[model samples]
Target: MSRFSFNQITAKLWDLPDLVAGCVEAGVGQVALWREPVTEYGLERSAALVRDAGLSVTTLCRSGFFQAPDWFDDNRRAIDEAAALDTKVLVLVSGGLPAGSKDLAGARQHVADAIAELVPHAAAAGVTLAIEPLHPMYAADRCVISTWDQAMAIAEQHPVGQVGVTVDTYHLWWDDTVLDRIARAGERIAIYQLADWVTPLPQGVLTGRGLPGDGCIDMAAFHAAVEKAGYTGPIEVEVMNAELWERPGREILDATLTSYRKVV
Candidate 1:
């Protein structure tokens, strides 16, 4: 990892301007921003904010909730937003099954088809639709793309520059075979995110992630595999703990840097 990026969700409560200043003070030259806050801060201004701070926007948080009715237009706009932010990678979290829908296979197929449709737009916008395989527990609601093979299957239909997979430790650590495949993924690996898996997950399973090295994942092994893939890109530390979010932004950045150094 050349630069450590502090993901916005890791400090969700932090204001965007304050986050930028804190990152600069912490010597973090990179960040992964979410769409909502970026939009709230105004797209052009958000881009200017990070640029003025001498920070790089690693990857836009997400776009692909294919099950949504307006996914087509929404994703295109998201692609444009990523371009506006000067980030090439736009992470896609393929939405899970539709409400009360039991056709899991159909839902998965829709995700593939939706991604295929978005490829040209993403390519035109100089963006890569990075498929993020959420953990299996999110299969029913958050994401249907829950494994490396599943994500790659859809991504392989397009060029690696336009479509690729996000290698996130919190989501992939349970899979023993993922590291080897990641080693061979080459250019298909678009972005890498870090978050440790801690036990006794909270309700909704969203804000329970631990910082790197604070849980069971062998982050060194992951780092080795990512390097083996010839990936020397920005590595984002994206922990979403409610407790961590409650702390002051500067304190969180300090702790995040400490955790990152321990694992890196």
Candidate 2:
């Protein structure tokens, strides 16, 4: 339980205040927050809410989308937000190829370049920029970094604490080589997120994730690999199931914790 971090998106419909109270009641001490809700609730107020409740924020859900024209400024603000929330890690979902562009190689390079530009600011803010590699299916319109190697290649170019990789089970489970690579990642692993992959993926495929142990993913294997990597950081359960979201916030948290216990 000390290592469990409930990613806020897992209970997407839960209001921030209710989520905090629910977590406190459930003995959940850590969370991974999304920027939209934080901004909507007032960043400072949200920060104080969690701080006052003794909750530790594991990471800021994401801030990348390098394809956006305002990527630089937006990511900078994200860093500030993460710092203000008292979190040390900010996950980056490197955006997919630009519209009307099919240059996969070029898009990947741009993501790397964008990270290089942000490393200084992240380091100064005492935040780690965690590059998350989404599944290959998201390559066209969601995230271009689609493998552990790609994310590590970019992260390795910067210092260890300043840049690192995010190992999310739902996104990386299909890669046969991922577990081995993850075992050797060491401190380069910034955050470890859990979500199983169920068949017949839902529309958009974004909200189709299953809770840990609820689908086909080998959660134990991932746990072993991460343990071998010496990652003693928060383990975030970040499922995004449409059906799951329909449940009450407390029910969602309870279900998530039950699933997490079965796997971990």
Which candidate achieves the best lDDT against the true structure?
2
Estimate, for each residue in 14-124, the C-alpha lDDT of model 2 and write its tens digit: 999999999999999999999999999999999999999999999998899999999999999999999999999999999989999999999999999999999999999
Evaluate model 1: give its TM-score: 0.98
Candidate 2 Cα outliers beyond 4 Å, as residue runs = none
lDDT of 1 by residue, 174-227 (tens): 998999999999999999899999887777468899999989999999999999
Best prediction by TM-score = 2
> Each model's TM-score, in the order given?
0.98, 0.99
Could you tell me the TM-score of candidate 2?
0.99
